[model samples]
Every structure is written in C-alpha cells, then in structure tokens.
Target: MNDQQLLRYSRHILLDPIGIEGQDRLLGSRALIVGAGGLGCPSALYLAAAGVGTLVIVDDDEVDMTNLQRQILHREQSVGRAKVDSARDALHDINPGTEVIALKQRLAGDALLEQVAAADVVLDCSDNFATRHAINRACVATRTPLVSGAAIRFDGQVAVFDSREPNAPCYHCLFPEGGESEEVRCAVMGVFAPLTGIIGTVQAAEALKILAQTGRTLAGRLLLLDALGMEWRSIALPRDPGCAVCGEGA
Candidate 1:
C-alpha cells in the first residue's frame, strides 16, 4: 500500500482484528452484489468505501423515484437510468480506485455462475425468491461465502452461508424452493427505509469479516430484525442433508 492508501485505510489498520494484514486482504478481494436496491445500496457503499479491490453489481431495473426512499446510491436525477449505471457512477464517486463492473441485465444460468465463481464473496441483496435460490445454488457450487440480506415492510433478515463449511445452511434450506412464501414487495407493502440500511450494513460487515478472515461469521445462524417492535432475534440454522442443490446425491 502506498502512503495515500495507508492514510485512506488507517482506521482499519488500527483495529486488532482487521489490522494491516486484514485490510490488505480486503484490498485484494472481489465481491459480487446481486442487486442495486435498498439492501444492495448500503452493502455497495461500505464495500466500495472500504477499498475492496473489485465490485461487480448486477441489476436489470431502472431507477425509480420510489426507490430513493431507501436506495441511497441513486439520486433524483438518476431516475429513469439503469440501476447498475447509476450505482457504478455512485461507487466511482466514492472510490474511483476500486474497479466497479456494472452488468445491466438479470444474471442467470452460466452468466450468473461465472460471476459467482469469479467473486471471493457474493452478497444476495435481491428481493425475490427465485434470484435468492439461484444465487445460493451458484455459491454452493463454487464454495464461495454468501452474505444474504432482505427487508420487506418492517421486517428484515440476514444470514451467511459458506458452502466451504460442512454443514452450513443455505438460503434454500431455510426457505425451500417449493415452499409457500407470500411474496411481499416493498412497492405493495411499505418498508421502513432504515430497515434496509440496517440489514445491508450487517451484510457488509459479514462480507468484510469473510474477506478479512476476522471473527467467526454467521454461518449457522440467521439474524432477524423487527423494525416496528425495535427488537432483534437470532435463529439457529441447520443444513438440510436432502437439499437438492447442495445434497450429496446432487
């Protein structure tokens, strides 16, 4: 690290857990974030600011005025623009040194697998079940650590899934593919704006810990938050031996 880099991340260097070595690891890491909405916004913000070597943001949606309520990466003028474009620009303004790849399309099949395989970590910030399951499958395939976060209405949840671990529960294990989950959209059911930030920030922390090899990650636990009640709870997660994606028979 140059003199400027030392100064830029001097605070991180002071931490015992993420000292110079850990900060250096963060600087050499690549992360793929699978959304540019509320959750993705804060995750991207902190990862970029922390000097992650490379950040890949994927999204096919355009910025909407309604999204501004929580998606801090987009501004009023960014409306109508592709979300990835706006997010890339915003991340650049924060840390031009960090390479940001903006893919303005929904990643699926080989495309998604390729990105997931290339990344050191994957953050599932998308707000849909299909995308979450797909991301989990790709992460499990690559043995990459995934930091997942979601927020709808006044509730939010976060979890870390590391296929590298023998019995870490994946997103599908907790919410099965064929399961009956009432899909709730922030558009239909109003979401508390800060709720997204809280969950996204936790995702960022988990991702950084994974990259820096700091404390133990939430590999076998799920963090849930009720913004309305202002309470937080954690649930232990167990891997499903019969999980189709990560099962031995698969």
Candidate 2:
C-alpha cells in the first residue's frame, strides 16, 4: 500500500481484526453485484469505498424518479440514465482506484455463469425472483460466496450463502425457485428509504467479511427486519438435502 492508500484506509487498518493484511485482501478482491437498484446501491458504495479492487455491476433498467427515495447511488440528475452507468459513476466518485465495470445488459444463463466464476464474491441485489434464482444457481455451480439482500415496503431481509462450505445453504435452499411469492414493488408498496440502506449495508459488511476472511459471514443464517415494527429476527437456514438447485440431487 502506498502512503496515500494507507492514509485512505487507515480506519480499517486500525481495527485489530482487520490490520494491513485484511485491508490488502479487500484491495485485491473482486465483487460482482447483480442489480443496481435499492440494495445494490449502498452495497456497491461501501464495497467501493472499502477499496475492493474490481467491481462489476449489472442491471438492464434505467433510473427513474421513484428510485431516488431509496437508491442512494443514483441522483436526480441521473434519472432516465442506465442504472449500471449511474452506479459506475457514483462508485468511481467514491473511490477512483476501484475498477468499476458496468454491464448495462441483463445477464443470465451462460453469461451469468461466466461472470460468477470470475468473482471472489457475488451479491444478489435484484428485485425479481427469476433473476435471483438464476444468480443463486450460478453461484452454487461456481462455489462462490453469495450475499443476498431484499427490501420492499417496510420489510427487509439479508443472508449470506457460502457455496464453498459444504453445510452452508444457498438462497434457493430457503426459498425454492418454483414456490409462489407475491411480487411486491416499491413503486406501489411505498418502501421505507432507510430500510434498504440498512439491509444493503449489511450486505456490504457480509461481503467484506467473506473477502477479508476476518469476521463471521452470515452463512446458513437469514436476517429479517420489519422497519415499521422496529423488529429484527434471524432464522437458522439449513442446507436442504434434497434442494433441487443446490442439493444432493443432481
């Protein structure tokens, strides 16, 4: 680390757990974030600020007025712009040293698998279930650690799935792909802005812990938060022996 790099990340180095070694790991890690919306916004911001060496943000949507309420990575001036472009600009502004790769196209199938195979950690910040399932499948196949987060209306949830761990559960283990889940959107449901921030920040924290190999990642545990009720709950998630997506059944 150069003199300027040391000064920039002095706070992280000050920690007993995260000394120079941990900070260096963070500076040499690659993180692939799917989605540039609410959860992805803060997740990308903190990861960039923490000096993740390479960041790849993927999202096919364009920013809208509604996103400003919760997506901190985008500003009013960025409305109507591609989400990946806005995210790239914001993250670069936060830390120019971090290589920000913005993929404006929606990734799936073979393309998604290739991306996951290259990343040290993958973050599922998408809104829809199909994309989430696809991302989970890719992560499982590559044995990559995944940090998943979701927030809509007054509810938020975050979890870490470490495919490298034999007993760790993937996102599909908790919520099966074909299972029915009501599609809820902030567009109609009215989300609490900071709720996304809380979950997104946790996503970043979990990713950093996994990359730095310092703290306990949220593997095999799911965190749920109800911002309106001001309640937080964590549930133990077990790897399903018969999970179709990532279980013993091939």
Candidate 3:
C-alpha cells in the first residue's frame, strides 16, 4: 500500500483481527452485488469504503422518486438514471480508488454465471425471488460465498451461504422459489427506512469477513429482524438434502 492508502485504512490496520494482513486480503478481493436498491446501496458503500479491490453492481431498474426514501445510493437528480450507474457514482465518490463496474442490465443465465465466477464473494441484494435464486445457483456452482439481505415493510433478514462449507444452506434452502410469500411492495406496504440500512450494513460486514477470512461467517444461520417490535431472532438453517438449488443431488 502506498503512503496515502496506509493512512486511509489505518483504522482497519490497527485492529488485531484485521491488521495489515486482513486489510491486504480485503484489497485483493472482488465482490459482486446483485442489486442497486436499498440493501445494495449500503452494502456497496461499506465495502468500497473498506477498500475492496473491485465491485460489480448489477441492476436493471431505474431510480425512482419513491426509492429515495431508503435507497441511499440514489439522489433526486438521479431518479431517471439506471440504478447501477447511480450506485457506481455514489460508490466512487465514497472511495475513488476502488474499481466499480456498473452493469445497467439484468444479469441472468450465462451473464450471471460469468459475473459470479469472477467474484470472490457475492452479495444477494435483489428484492425479487427470481434474481435471488439465480444468484444463489451461480454462487453454488462457482463455490463462492454469498451474503444475502432483504428488507420490506417493517421486517428484514440477512444470511450467508458459503458453498465452501459443508451443510451450509443457500437461500433457496430457507425460502424456496415459487413458494407462497406475502406479496408486499414498499410502494404499497411502506418500508422503515433504517430497516434496510441495518440489514445491508450487516450484509456488508459479513461480506468483508468472508473476504478477509478474519472471522466466522453466518453460513448456516439466518438473522430475522422485526423492526416494528424491535425484536431480533436467529435461526439455524440446515442444508436440504433435496434442495433444488444447492443440494447434493441438485
């Protein structure tokens, strides 16, 4: 690291757990974040600020005025812009030295595989089920660790799925695709702004831990938050022997 970089990341270097070695690992890591909305915003910001070497952001949506409430990466002036572009700008502003690749298009099938294969870790920040399942599949195939986060209404959840670990459950193992889930959107049900921030920040922390290999990750655990009741609970998730996404027979 240069003098400027050493000084910039001195705080991280000062820690016993993250000393200079962990900081170097962070600077050598590449992360793929699969959304650019609320969860993606804070997750990307924290990763960038921590000096992650490369960040690939994928989002096909444009920033909407309604998104400004919790999507901290987009500004009012960026409402009409693609979310990935806006996120790239915000992340660059946070850490200009970090490489930010903004793909303003939906990543699926081959595209998703290529991106996930190149990343050391994947962050599932997408709001919908299809993209989440696709990301999980790609991560499992590539044996990459995934940090997943979601927030809607007064609830949020975060988890890590590492295919490197035995018996670790991917997102599909916990919430199967095509299953019955409450169909609620922020536009209709309303979101607690800080709720997204809380989960996304946790996602970022987990991602960093996975990248630096400095601490234990939540590979087989799921954290659920009920912001309305100020309650938090954690559940142990077991790998499904028949999980369609990452099972032994899958």
Best by lDDT: 1
Q: Would you list the C-alpha lDDT of every candidate in the order shown? A: 0.94, 0.93, 0.91
When summed lDDT is taken over every stretch of 10 residues in candidate 2, the lowest stretch is 180-189
TM-score-wise, the better of 1 and 3 is 1
How far off is model 2, as Cα RMSD? Answer: 0.9
The lDDT ranking, best first, is 1, 2, 3
Q: Report model 2's TM-score to 2 decimal places.
A: 0.98
- Give the runs in model 3 whose Cα sits over 4 Å from its true position: none
Candidate 1: the clashing residue pairs are none
Better by TM-score, candidate 2 or 1 = 1
**Model 2 spans with C-alpha error above 4 angstroms:** none
What does candidate 2's lDDT look like per residue over 1-250, in tens digits? 9999999999999998999999999999999999999899999999999999999999999999989988999999999999999999988899999999999998989999999999999999998888988999999999999999999888999999998897788888888888877878777878899998999999999999999889887899999999999999999999998898788884
Judged by lDDT against the true structure, how good is candidate 2? Answer: 0.93
Instruction: Give per-residue CA lDDT, model 1, range 1-250, as digits (tens).
Output: 9999999999999999999999999999999999999999999999999999999999999999999999999999999999999999999999998999999999999999999999999999998899999999999999999999999999999999999988887888888898998788898998999999999999999999999999989999999999999999999999888988887766
RMSD of each: 0.8, 0.9, 1.1
**What TM-score would you give candidate 3 relative to the actual structure?**
0.97
Question: In model 2, what lDDT does residue 239 have?
Answer: 92
